[model samples]
Target: MDLFSGTTFKRAVAAAVALPLAGGATLVAAGPAAADEEDYKILVVGKTLGFRHSHIDDTTRALIDLGEDNGFTVDVWDPPNDSAGWWGSGSPGQPDLTMDSTPFTSAEDLSQYATLVFVSPVDNTNSLNPATPRLLDDTELAALQGYVHGGGGFVGLHAATDTMHTVPWYGELTGGGARFASHPQQQTATMRVESPAHPSTAHLPAVWERFDEWYNYTTNPRADVHVLLTLDESTYSPGNNAMGEDHPISWCQNFEGGRSWYEGAGHTDASWTDPLFLEHVLKGVEWTAGVVEGGGNCVTFPEVDAVVAGLNTSAVGDGVIAGAIASLLGSARTAAEAGDPATAVQVLGGARSLVDHLSAAAGDRDLLASKIDDLVDWQTGLVDDGPALDLAAEAELRTMGGKQYLAVRVLNEDDAAVDITVTTPYGSKEFAAVAPTKNAYQAFATRLVEVPAGEVTVTATAVLDGETVTEEVAVAYAGTA
Candidate 1:
């Protein structure tokens, strides 16, 4: 049995409306019959074994609209059984489907479309029958494997992971298996972006707050997968899924020779219609169908604003606070890259106020921290780090390295050795200063540093023959805890 049982809408009002509209009466009978046909071909594999009416109905309508707009043919595969049922009238206004399209029964049937959309159910978790009927049992699995391996695209929406948990290949293909360990019975949480450079998320807001059943998967095989969006725990209750600190809500991965994407936030009817949420799904679908080249990361103005605000509030006013905030911003950037936006936001939010006030004060320390925050945010999103180059800028930061060390590179010039100073929370240490004889642009680079789990500051000052040129840039470092 599939995760959800389908319900028959024997007398649904939508069915009545759809009949007349689909019969060529909507446009007042315009254009040639073939010219009016939709373009893209999509297969919406509805509930066959584990079916849900609401899920199918909502997603089906959305896909239909997308197909019409994007020129795709939508074929819904809905098969009926005694335990689970299909909804659609035999005619235009009826409640039962006019036809039964069971693509899972044969490979030939499944090959009719270019892309296959999985909308929830696979097998029954609670079954009474001796022989279980799975969506990708014998025939459908082979067809799907061939389709994707042959370059066919796959899209999974909302409860896609909720299905096909029993199949190892399916689990590997989707990057995880079903485990409804802890999900919010009601919805209210923020979805943040851990990766901001991916294509689908370029336009998405940093934190997506909505109501829906959030699924916590058994395993998150997303370290290597391209993560588009992540769930922030501070926004909702952490459920049963024992995963990392930051959880993934949407992601795309390359499977075999095919592309696949899964989004786990569409369990409600409202989600299907919300313009923002719907837009996200549309982007994902287009990406999977090979219509789009790359997806932007899920970074939004809100998250960035939040970080900015956080820095202003915490450590931007006082010189000491400024120095601390700069270090914090560095740590936040590291956390963001490590797929922990919550931690990144937390670190930034905690220090925003201080940094803002310090910047107003025009204190060198405060300005330095503010600058660090900007650089960190840019680095996390793969944006430009060099803004207005402040030659008058001055900051003091610490660098701790054993084998791997820091190097500085100026714009349009060769790499130059940088003279840096390290300051522990307790004291300070000075390293041998390697001064450049001539003027060329310079930037900093360093390998991953392993330090004790504590806060440290790194400051760099450019000196030319005992005279200071550029202001110091201070960066905070938080060692592994």
Candidate 2:
């Protein structure tokens, strides 16, 4: 039985409206009379063997409408299944694709389409489900890979990351540098356009706020791909805060032999109707189809260097500690300039440790701390090193002697003897010798202190390698128990 022999194949090749090009011009596909007809065809696959979104059908219709407006032909394909039922089951305009066989049974069938748009093609979590049919068998997966590597285009929608978790090749092909870890409650948050020059984000504002499920990736993709949009974590309650302040929501990259684009937005049905969002999708489609040219490659070390230099000028302060930080920064820049981003990142990591110690010692919290954080973020995004020191302070509420106290945790990543001195508003304490361990350099030091109800500045000093470095941090005290 031929899978696409019925209405499925017929509808897939159904004629679409002429595609409109730039300057109000339209590219008409040659009619049946022509021996070789050239058509701009798009395939939208919304097959999900796992958790499905209610907006899948709506998204498909929206793309079809876009095709009509832009002069291209779109074919929407949803897997022939009703095991879990549709989003709005039994409702009018709901997609009902029925087929006796699979459409993507061979490479020849899949190669007919030029651009492939995956709208949440999720797989089941149970890898051992023998009864359930695999979305793309080994052959089909290879065919799709060959197609994309042969210059075909791919655009992955919202839950694309949630799909194909078992297939490692699919991850690389879709620019799944990071898997979807989790998402917070659907809320409105500001999205900063990272690559305004790219076609996908060129129409977007510098900072645009929209409501959707903001996702946190298991790994940050900024280092491996060109990020188009980043969710401003400060603008919303980032549920887990896993990706830190610089969270990327959308990115694009030229992967393998084809163009790959993925955006973390589009979880809601309303998003399909949004003009700006639709335009963004259209631009990505056009870019993948070779209609527009930009978003060339992933970010390089030089770009990271430029950002680091700017941050150093604006954020770094003055002191003996500051001088040491400046020297480390210089060395990192030199390493990067010499085409050693890994070494640069390692040196930057050491600088971050020094900054963390300084921030704890001097009791200067906001400005210098923020600057160091920015530098560390940039450094982390440039390379992948295992088990490196992430210098930062953590605060926790504690009770000491039947009184409320703020416990501050200052961490050090290196394995060296560090001399620590802490000065609080109440009194000063010094630890002559702090031993190093894998967990922390100063494990025995008491970061907990008692102060009046309000904000109080505390200074810490660390003497290491015969150099004295100091930092200050402001601690807020609620009240005594």
Candidate 3:
């Protein structure tokens, strides 16, 4: 029987090729080699136009080892030599190190490799010398866009999120929207595996404790991509705590027509040598290389534009209600324009609630409410937010005597004393008299609550005079009681 139409004749001939040996023994033949036997080609691009990592060489070695151990070929691309005078150091006694000076100038040049891995590519960080060359030019950026949209694969590590800021297309290719804002000091923190079934995280524990620079992204990409790992803010001290509770440390997405995976875990040199971390990276590479089957696609660009238009349209009209809606809409628009879509989404949620309250105030409640709903729905779809709350609070996970507890620190910017209520999945507790410090706009209040061992969502509510503000944060607990 013929398995395939085009290969029937070839199969028939091969089947009839059996012959007797010189010793009068019949020879048995084996089938064709499997597809896995073929070697996969990978391109490791570690070209930093800004702050370079000391572990770049180690990362390259780890990737080379991963390729050798697996059935793949690794080609490391360093930036300085590829662009020549476009990138170089002014210091003396510098070896002027370069790895494979071949430039990726076009889509054709990029097509030869199955996937591209970026290791801490930074640009324009050195203010002393403003003439630092960028890693990707206009044409090359266009090529990368075309490549990813044409079903290429991309894996970004550490400062890959920090690179190619000037090029919007590059950002979109490497899951751009949410850029690196800041990172706390290198400390040990627990990471919750959002997608344990994912090949990149299947071997990881439910809660992974690792030491590295935990990045606090400017905005949460959870609304845009499939988050694979999230840093438990309560597990470690977050310097800025800008992202609040839901902080995504690593995520993957099937962007456009290509596969994209990014992990913010490789800031230190030891990360490249860790078996678990290396395995995680190797699995990401394999997935991008089409060796594995998983990842998420993003919302279409046209859909996002349509939502933005709706937001603009809903902000129009004439009335006191309209003026209030317009004011809130203006705030949302400013946040989005300032490259903080997360805040914009949160503000829009407040705007939606204000519109809801205007049902009795609006002259045409039905018509105006419908328009407002459409706008809120469209805008909210592009970004994710928790409950709308004015005050910000920090929740820290703690354990003592085998009992898991949450040490929540509340910050109130309001002048009046606010009554705070902290609720855990296990139970709820209230803290009274959270007052601002003397002559300071910030106030601090601390609360400790016992929680069951597992992942739990903690909600903090603050009542000022009469108005109530609520915010919820999730924390992972790995304790006995």
Judged by whole-model lDDT over C-alpha atoms, candidate 2 comes out at 0.60
State residue 17's C-alpha deviation in candidate 3, in Å: 47
Worst 10 residues of 3 by lDDT: 7-16
| Residue-level error in angstroms, candidate 2, position 55 | 1.3
lDDT of 2 at 117: 86
User: Could you give candidate 2's per-residue lDDT for residues 213-265 as a string of tens digits?
Assistant: 88887688766666778988888888874577778888876566567788888
Q: Model 1, residue 85: displacement in angstroms?
A: 12
For TM-score, the strongest prediction is 2
Give the Cα RMSD of candidate 2: 23.6
Once fitted onto the true fold, the runs of candidate 2 whose alpha carbons sit more than 4 angstroms away are 1-39, 82-101, 126-133, 295-481
Please state every model's RMSD to the true fold in angstroms: 24.9, 23.6, 21.7
* lDDT measured at residue 112 in model 1 versus the true structure, 0 to 100: 49
lDDT of candidate 3 over 1-481, digit per residue (tens): 3111211101101111111110111111101112344676788877665556777778888898888898778777774423323345521111233444544677677776778898786765323243555567667777777777767789999888877665555666566476777888899999987655456776787889999988877567765666778988888899984577788888877676677889988888999889999988988887776665421122222223333333322423424555666677778767755756557657766666665554342344554444444334333333423223334444444544544444444454456555656554445556666675311111112133433454434344555446565555444434334
Q: After superposition, how far is residue 269 of candidate 3 from its true place, in Å?
A: 0.9
Worst 10 residues of 2 by lDDT: 5-14
